[model samples]
Target: MISRRLRETAVAGPFLSVKGLVFGLFILVPFVYTFILTFQRGSLLTGMRWGGLSNYRTVVTDTLFRDALKNTLLFMLVCTPVTLVVSAAVGLLLSSSLRGMAVHRALIYLPSLLSVVATGLIWKVLLDPEQGPLHLLMLRGFGLDVPWLTNGTVAIVLLAFITAWSTCGFYGLVFMAAFNGIDTELLEAARIDGAGPWQVLVQIKLPLIQPVAQVVLALLTINCVQVFDLVFVLTNGAPGTATYTAMWYVYQNAFNGGSVAYAATMSVMLLILTALISALFLARRTGADADA
Candidate 1:
C-alpha cells in the first residue's frame, strides 16, 4: 500500500508543481506587482517613483473617478437583481421537460457564446438612433425618435439591459443546474401537500437554491462592476461620461490619460470592492447554511 501511494504521489507531484508555478507566474505575480505599482507614480515610458498613497488620494479627488464609481455602483444596483431574477425565471421555465426544450435552451445560451465585443457591436448597431432597425422601426412605424445611445438615462438603462441579455443565458444555465439538482421527491411531496407553483418556487425551490443564487449574485456583481469591453464598444463612455464605468476609468487613466500608477490605484480599489462584496455574500451564505 505504501509503495502504491508513493507511485501515485510521484506521478501527480510534477504536474501539481508545474500548475502552481504557472499560476504564480501568471496570476499571483502580476497581482502583487499591480498592488506595488499602485504606490508608485509614473507611466511605463517614464520611470516610476514611489508616491505612497498619493495615487489613491488623487483617485479619491478626481471627478472622473467619482463619476465612474457612481456609475459602476448604479450599474451593479440595476443589473444584478434583474439579471438574477430573469435568469432564475428563465431557468425554471426551461427546466420543464417539454418537447423542443433543448432547442430553446440552445437559443437562450447562444448570446453568451458570442464574444463581448461582438455582443456590444451587435447591440450598438441595433440601438443606433438613426439607421438601426429598432430605431428606424420606432421612428417610421410609430413616429418616435428615441435616442437609445444619445440620451444619458436611456443610454445607461439600455446598457444595463444589453448586459443582462448577454449574460442571462450563462446564469440561466447555472440556475438550471441548481434547479435540476433539486430533489423531485420533495417537490412532489409539496405538491401533494397542496402547494401551488408560486408557493413551491418561493418557499421551496428558492430556499433550496440559495447557495447557487449567492454564487450567481457574486459573479454578476463582479462582472457588472468590472464592465468595460461592452461599454467601450457600445457607448465609449459617451453622452458626457454618463456611462463611464470604473474599469473604463482605469483603462483611460492607464492608457489614455497616461497615469499608470493612478490607474493601478483605481484597479486596487475595484479589487478591494469586489473582494468585500464576495466576502459579504459568502458570509451570508455561511450564516444561512448554519441556520438551516
Candidate 2:
C-alpha cells in the first residue's frame, strides 16, 4: 500500500529535518534530563545525591500533592468547558456578517496576543480585594466585596474563568476558521427544508466542527492541568495554600524548597496523569459522539 507521507511524518519525523534536530535538542533532551533527575535527590545548588524511588515514595504519601492533584483536576474540568463554550461563542460572533465585525474580532482576539504572565498580572490587579477598580465598583453597586484571590473555591473558579477568557481569543479564531470552512449550500438547504437558525446550528454546524472541538478540548485539558504562571502571579497558591495546584506544588519543591529531584518525580507523575486524562477524555467523547 502507498503510504501517507504526511501521516507518517507527523507521528515520526522527516528525513534529515532541522525540526527533528531541534526537537531532540530541546524537548527530548530536557525530558530525558528531568526523568534522570527523578531518581536522584538534591538540587544543583546543594549538589546531587543518589536516591532510588525515595521521591516516588514521598509523592505517594504526601497529602499536599494529593490536594494539589485534586485542585489541578478541578481546574481542568472547570477551565476546559468554560474555554470551549466561550471560544465557540466568540467564534460564532466573529463569523457573523455584522457591521464592524473586523474591529470586534480584533478586540476579541487581543487577549490571546498577550503573554499569560501579562494576562495574570492584569487580572490580579483588577481583582484586588481592596484597591481594585472592579472590586470598588462591585462594592458600591452590587455591595459585594468578594474575596477574589483569598477564598479557595472563589479563587479557583476565578482562575479557571480568567484562563478561559485569556484562551478564548486563540481558540475562537480556530473555530471561526472551522465555521468558515462549512459549506454554505448545506446551510441553505437546511433553511429551505424549514430548519431554523437554532436547529441548523445544533444539527449541522456543531457536528461539522466536531473535529476542531476535539482538538481544542484536548489542548484545554492539557494546558489547564499544567497551569502555573497565573497561579504564581495571582495568589502564589496563597490563602493558606488554598489554591495549591499540582504544578504549583512542584514549583515550590523545585525552585523554593530545594528538592529538584522530588519535583522531577512529581513532574513525571504529572506527565503520566495528563496523558491518561487527555486519552480518557478523547475516548469518552469519541464514543459518546459516535453513539450520538
For 122-227, candidate 2 gives per-residue lDDT tens digits of 9878877768888988999999888888789888988999999888999999999999999999999999999999999999999988878988998898898799
Q: After superposition, how far is residue 169 of candidate 1 from its true place, in Å?
A: 1.0
Model 2: residues >4 Å from true position, as ranges?
Answer: 1-17, 281-292
Across 199-221, the per-residue lDDT of candidate 1 in tens digits comes to: 99999999999899999999999
Q: Which residue pairs show backbone clashes in model 1?
A: none
Best model per TM-score: 1
The number of clashing residue pairs in each candidate reads: 0, 0
Which residue runs of candidate 1 sit more than 4 Å off their true CA positions? 1-6
| Per-model lDDT | 0.89, 0.89
Scored against the true structure, residue 138 in model 2 reaches a CA lDDT of 92
